[model samples]
Target: MKAAREARSAAVVINAGSRRGAASTELAVDAMRRAGVPVRSVHPVKSGTELFQTLRRVVADGHDLVVVGGGDGTMTSAAGLLAGTDIMLGVLPLGTANDFARTLEIPGGLTEACAVIADGKVVDVDLGWANGEPFLNVASVGLSVGVTEALSPRLKRRIGSLAYGIATMQAYARHKPFRARLEFPEGDHEPMELEDVLQVAVGNGRHYGGGNIVSPMAGIDDHTLDIYAILAAPLREHVKIARLLKDGSFIEHDRVYHLATRRVRLVTEPPLSVNLDGEIAAVTPADFSVQRNAVHVIVPQSSNSASFEGPSRH
Candidate 1:
């Protein structure tokens, strides 16, 4: 645990892209000032490495907390640096699908989010890793990757989640099945050939693909990872699954398989494209593992109940 003086003097780093909320970066700075917390610095980042570099500087400067203001991708990028460290991460949900923020019950509005941060109740959260990259939401291979690849930034900003919905329709028309072998650390291996598989999502949190609830029962503090495999199906079935997801009924669907594991290795007959926390990573065969209690997060004390509740696989 960091000392009180250290926590109060912590610096916050916000991704400029996360500036969509009404409480602009200026308000964040002003709030920090009002709280009598010194503003170490606020830096803008364009790519993943840049975010890491800024985080490193913040840590080296003895800042006890690192606050990120962008969407999931930006948060994932910064998470790798804070894992296993003493720095408490504060999130300002400014991205398209603030899935992590939603799970934490952090409001979308910046002012509310900042108020939560100012309260400064710290929580320990679990983070998952694919190879070495940190992902707070989910990572997957197959149709979902196709949809992510097809959606342009302009379309995403203009249409929001509708862009992914449109991409799913287009991807469904071009879907094909593939053979994959999933090997768990306990020596359980399952080899299956799938057709029209929407995708395979390995979730650390409960949401992905723009609030699609890829792993409806996932818990961030749990030491396990949720692996959700969506087999390719007809357009009608795919639409049905999408609808079921909103109501938390997708878990009972026949085409979906959910597993809880500490580590998983995926091998595909043909190389498959993969997305890690919404960012494209190398193609399959990928190795995934959970880093238990991997990072410290600054969350509201009021949300403590939900934070510790184990993930539901129902």
Candidate 2:
């Protein structure tokens, strides 16, 4: 994938449904071209189906670069298509929570992001997989899934990043505790059974839930998945934990169990929806693995996030 691309052109795909997607599409296209990238095709797609088709076509067309605009969900979709391939991804963070972009230190402004695409270096980043679906940030079950359901488009457009907090609170009231077991495939840890869990999350990248850290030690290029299972607790205790979420110190709480491994398997009593980034990508009885250096992307030259050398695919 490190080899030179025969055609050095780039395609841009922006998800129109995202908060700033519709507003930023044309600006992104113009700014990218202005930044001196070899821009070819530009698409402001309104649906996931269209976004999929457009990304597939650009890859088939042999474009050297694929510039994706929108949130984590849109980036997750693009990663599924572009991972393990030679094409480089240029991100435009135009959604409510640009979690993946934040992990890479890719700024939020259209002009700044475009500049990075044009002048940045390429680096390989890991993607977490749940039942074969790819996610650039955290993937989880339980209350997080409810939060995803509560995040309506109108609500996000109105409150921006604050929407995540509002939705989490709204979902918390209706969250149902579930039972589950975790088995580490690498045998790094003994299998464990658990009961009445608020959430079980497997994180590949550091930032999620807007700007919350998965763990202080977690990193997208770390080649390991960060796993955390928070035991359901009393309201008074949970409020204290919520305060620690922003700094990822919540993982140190007595109720929050944390581990880092290459892979793990999660099984729930009554299969529950799994939230991958923001989309419900899978259900329980899930197999989770770290796709180490699964995707190559552009990031600011000043970013300390990923290794500049490309991935060595096994």
- Please give the CA lDDT of all the candidate structures: 0.73, 0.89
Clashing pairs in 1: 196-232, 197-231, 197-232
Query: How does residue 177 of candidate 2 score in lDDT?
Result: 94
Looking at model 2, report the run of 10 residues with the lowest lDDT sum.
1-10
- Per residue, candidate 2 scores C-alpha lDDT tens digits across 1-314 of 43213228999999999999988988888887776888888888999899899889988998889999999999999998888787889899999989899989999999999888888878899888899988889999999999999999999999999988889899999999999899988899999899999999999999999998999899999999999999999999999988998889999999999999998999997799999999998998999988777788888888888874565452
Error of 1 at 15 (Å): 1.7
The lDDT of model 2 is: 0.89
Which candidate number maximizes lDDT?
Answer: 2
**Model 2, runs deviating above 4 Å:** 1-7, 312-314
TM-score, model 1 to reference:
0.89
Error of 1 at 59 (Å): 2.3
